[model samples]
Target: MTARHRFDPTILREYDIRGVVGITLCEADAHAIGRSFATVVLREGGRRIVVGCDGRLSSPMLEKALVAGLTASGADVVRIGLGPTPMLYYAEASATDIDAGIQITGSHNPRDHNGFKFVLHGHPFFGAAIQNLGVMAAAGDWEEGAGTCEDRPVLAAYVNRLLEGLAGVDPARLAALRIGWDAGNGAAGPALERLTARLPGEHHLLFTDVDGHFPNHHPDPTIEANLADLKALVAREKLDFGVAFDGDADRIGAVDAGGRVIWGDQLIAIFAEDILRRQPGATIVADVKASRTLFDAIARQGGHPVMGSSGHSLVKAKMKEIDAGLGGEMSGHVFFADDYYGFDDGLYAAVRLMAATVRLDRTLAQLRDAMPETFSTPELRFPVDRARKFAAVGEVHARLAKAGAQVVDIDGVRVTTPDGWWLLRASNTQDMLTARAESDTREGLERLIGEIDAQLALSGLSRA
Candidate 1:
C-alpha cells in the first residue's frame, strides 16, 4: 500500500493549483497531485500523460516527484522537461496519443510561488475537477501500478509552427519590420530566443536566459514598471514594435514604435481587425475588464463581440461554446482558435501580432493612432476578505438592480451609461475586488469612478 498525503486546501484553486513554495506547496503536494490526476485520467481510459515544468528553481524536484506519483498510479509519463506552460499545452494539442498535460509553472507569480495548470484531452481541467482531485487524494484512492517514463524534445517543432503564422505575410514587409522581444528571464526565454532567431528582419531580444531568480525584473508584463526595459530597448534600437512574455509565457504584452504600451484589449482589437478581414463576421471575445473601444471595434469590423468572464479557463471555455475565432483577457492572456489551438500562448500571440501588422500594411503606431481615444482608469484592485468578497459583490449587484442601471452581470456587474462603461468584479484567483471605468471625456470618467466608489461604500468596503 502507498502512503497517501493531503494538500493544503488553499493550494487547490478555481482555475489551477497554486500556492507559495515550501510553505503552502511542496514536493509531497506535487506527488499527490500527480497520483490523483493520473487516477482520474486512467479511469477515463487514458494511459499516457504529458508533463512539463517552468525554469523555477524548485520545478525539477517537483517534476521528479510528480512523475513518480504518476507512474506509481500506472500512468505513462512523457516528460518534456523545462519550458513555458503554453509549450506543454502545444505538446498535448499536437500529440494525438497524449491524454492530458500538466505544466508545473508559477505563471507570473512571485519566485516563491508555484502551481499546476492542466489540460485533459485539450480541454481545461479546472474548477470542480480540481476540487475532486483533492477529494481523491485525501481518500488515498489512486490506482496502483508501475508505468513508464520518457523524455522528448519538441521545442524546435513548436517554434517552427509559430513561425508559420507569417505564411501569407509579405516577405519584404516582414523583412523591413524590426522588432524587440523580452522574455523577462522566465520559462519562455529560450523559446523566444529561438523564435526571434528564425523570424524575419532584425530582432532584438532582452533577458532571454532562463533564470528562476528573475534577477533582472519581475516576469509579469501587465504592470507598466516591468516593461521599462523592453520599451527602452525599442527606443534605443529604433524597433518597429516590442513584445514581452510573463513567467510561463502564456500572457503577452507589447509596445508600439513610440514606446507606448499597448494593453491586452488593444492588441485583441488589432487582431480582430486583421482576422475579420480574412474570416468575415468571425466572433471575437474579450473579458469584461476590456475597454468599450475593443468591443465596438470588433462590431465595426463585422465581427460579433462577446464580453467574457476574467480568467484563462473561463475565457477558453466561453470561446469554445461560441466557436469564437479569437478571445483574450485584459491580463494579457490571448487565445486564437482561428488557425491554432484555443490556448493562450504569449509567444504565438506576438508572432501573430507581427503578422497582422505586416498583412494590414500599417505601422503598429499608426494602427494604434487610428483607434478612438477614450479616457480610462487602469484596472484597480483592492484587497477584500475572501469570505466577504462575494457577499460584497452581491450587495453591489442588488443596489445596481434597485437603481435600474443597464448592467451586465454574467460574471460581475458591468454598468453602462451615456458616457461609457464601468466594471466591478471579484477576482476568481484572489481575495481582491477589481474595478475599471472608461469614458469619452474626463468628466464622464470621473462620474463613473464616483459611482464605483459609492457602490463599494454601500458594501461596507472602500478602495485601498
Candidate 2:
C-alpha cells in the first residue's frame, strides 16, 4: 500500500500555496499540491498546465514532486523550467492548449521560503479557491490518472516576444550610457545576461548566478537596503542607471545616475505617459499607496487612473476587470496590457523603460526630471500578530472616521487631509502592519506620519 502523508493545513493560503522549508511544508506536501491542483484543473476540463519555479533551492525538488502529482491526476504538464512569475503567466495566456499555470516561487520572501502562483481558466485561482484545495487534499480527494510531464522552454519564446516590440528602438546614445544590474542571484540572471548582449551599453553585474541562498542582498528591491550595492555600483561606475530584481524577477527597482531610488509610481508615470502617447486615452491602474502625481499625470495624458487593493493576484484581477492598459504597485509589480498579456514582467518593464528613454531622446534622469515632485514616505512595516493585524486596521479606520478625517478603505484606511494623505493597512503576505504617507511638502508628509504613529501607539504597536 502507498504511504499516506499528513497534510499541513498552513501550506494552503488565500492566494497560493506557501510555507517554510520543513516545518510547514516539504516535498510530500508539494506532491500533494501538484496532484490535488492537477485534479482540480482536470475537473475543470483543463488539458494543459504550465509550471515554473524561482531560484529557491527547494523549488526544483518541490516542482518535480508537484509535476508527479499532476501526472498522477492524469493531466499533461508543460514545465516552463526556470523563469520569472510573469513568464509562466505569459505561457498560459499565449498557449491555446494551456488552461492553467502554476509558478513555484516564494517571491521576495526570505531565502528559506517558497510558494505557488496558480491560474485557472485564465483567471486568478485564489482566496476561497485556494483554501478549498487544502481541505480536498487533506481528504485525499485528488484524482488518479495517466498524467505525463512535458518539458517546454518558454524563456526563449518569451524573450522573443518582448524584443519584437522593442526591436525598432535604437541604442546609439544608450551605447554611451553605462548600466548596472543586480539580479540578486535570482532566476532572472541567466536571461538578463542574454538581454544585455543585445543592448549597446557599458554594463556591470552583481549576483548573476542563480543561487537560492541570496547571499549578497535580498532579492526584494522595494526595500532601501537591498539597493545599497546597486547604488554603489552606479556611483562607482558613474552609470546612467542601475536595476535590481526580486527573487522571481517579476518586480524591479532602479537607481538614477545620481544614485537615487525611483519608486514604482514614478516608473509607472514614465511608462504611462509614453504608452498613452501611442495609445491615447488608455486606462492605468495603481495601488492606493502610489502618489497622487501618478494619477494626475495619467489624466493629463488623456488616460483614466484607478486605484485598487495591494496584492499581485488582486491587482491582476482588477486590471482585467477594468481592461487597463497598465497597472503597478509600490512594491514593484507592473502589469502591461498594451502590447503583451496583462501580467507583471520586470524584464519586460525594463525593455519598455529602455525604449521609452531612447525614443524620447531623454536620459533616464532627464525624463525623471520632467515629472512633478511630491514628498512621500517609504513603506514602513511593523510587526503585528497575524490575528490582530486586520483588527488593528479596522480599529484605526473606525477611529479615523469618527474623528472626522477623510478616509478611503479599499485595502486599508487611507486618510486624505488638507495637507496630504496617510495609509495604514495589514500586509497580505506577512504578519505586519504596513503604512505610507505622502504630501505636497515635507511638513505635510511629517503630519501624515505623525497621524499613523498615534494610531499605532493606540494599538500597542511601535515604529521601532
Query: Candidate 2 residues 1-464, lDDT tens each?
Result: 44344567666766677889887878888887877788888888886889999889999898988888888878899998888888898899989989999999998988888989899887888888887777777678877888777888887777777776476667576567688999998989888887777766788888889999988988999998999999999999888888899999999898899988888988999889888888989989999889888989999889999999988788889999999989998889888888878788898888788777877778789878887788888888888888899999999988988989888899999889988888999887678888999899999999889889999889888778
Backbone clashes, each candidate: 0, 1
CA lDDT of each candidate?
0.93, 0.86
> For model 1, what is the alpha-carbon lDDT of residue 99?
97
Error of 1 at 440 (Å): 1.1
TM-scores of the candidates in the order shown: 0.98, 0.94
Model 1, poorest ten-residue lDDT window?
Answer: 1-10
Model 1 regions lying over 4 Å from their true place: none
Off by over 4 Å in 2: 1-9, 171-177
Q: Write model 1 residue lDDT over 8-63, tens digit each, in one string.
A: 98898889999999999998999999999999999999999999999999899889
Q: Which pairs clash in the backbone of model 2? A: 71-147
Model 2, 420: alpha-carbon shift in Å? 0.3
